[model samples]
Target: MNVKQWMLVVCFLCSGTKYIPNTCRTFGSGVVQPFQGSGFYVRSNCPFTLTRLTHNRVECDVSIRRGKNGLLVQVEIIINKVRTVLQNGNILVEDQSVSLPYDHTYENIFQYGIYTRLRSSLLPLTVTWHTVPAGIDTLWVRTAIFIRKS
Candidate 1:
């Protein structure tokens, strides 16, 4: 197929995909790796934080406007943590390290489900995305966090 035709085909297939627990904007702290963070739905412009409702210090006075990137996940982090989320699904806790552009705009460099889960270290969070595991699991959080150490 040509570039235009290929683009349409890609969009059609991607539209069917959704983000797990990609709704919550004002999310609390802590990890919901076990609970799957929440549920998935059609993608939107809102950002997602991998915080569970049951964690302490849940209510964060996070000024989203100050978020270096267009995502709050990066804002919540004070510094860079040992690059959370290993290639094998391990998470580095309390790692403040975040990598993102200073601009508040987002770019879909990997809209085709590149990462199983989004890491705090990454910025301009993937608002509209689909992970490979979501196909086999309904309670899957496309951008879920992992508590276990690598």
Candidate 2:
């Protein structure tokens, strides 16, 4: 083969024509209870209500109302099969006074491989939150998820 032919072969091999799986599942939202006045609390048992529907996408939205004191909301997203952590951290919003509200939304791509891995697996993803100020008597949070279509 000539040099030109060899280059063409290499280019074809490196082309981005490979097919990628595009299947994902999503979970619904739920409420999270906050700690009592002037104290710390960890929400490890927070549950994500998942639902199977059209389109392969994942979406989550959380809202919170802090009382007189400020509060911190922590969220974590994980892909169980690959043992990967997509997102993990905390979002802190201060309550200037009573009824301080905050909202957050997240979306991710779920390919075929990821969808299959999570299909029969429990705890495919997890989210957690905690209150900051000890005096903050109220904490409220909600979450949701979506998966893409195959």
Off by over 4 Å in 2: 1-55, 72-125, 131-150
lDDT of 2 by residue, 1-150 (tens): 799857855664566333232222211122233322232333333333222222234333332322222232222233221222221122222311112122222222223321211121232232322322332222222222222333
Q: How close is each model in CA RMSD to the real structure?
A: 16.3, 17.1
Residues 7-119 of candidate 1: C-alpha lDDT, one tens digit per residue = 85567456663323434333222212333255333222343443323223322211111122222223222212212321112222244322332221222122234433332
Residue 19 in model 2: lDDT:
26
lDDT of 1: 0.29
TM-score of each: 0.19, 0.19
Highest lDDT, which number? Answer: 1
* Candidate 1 off by > 4 Å: 1-21, 27-75, 78-150
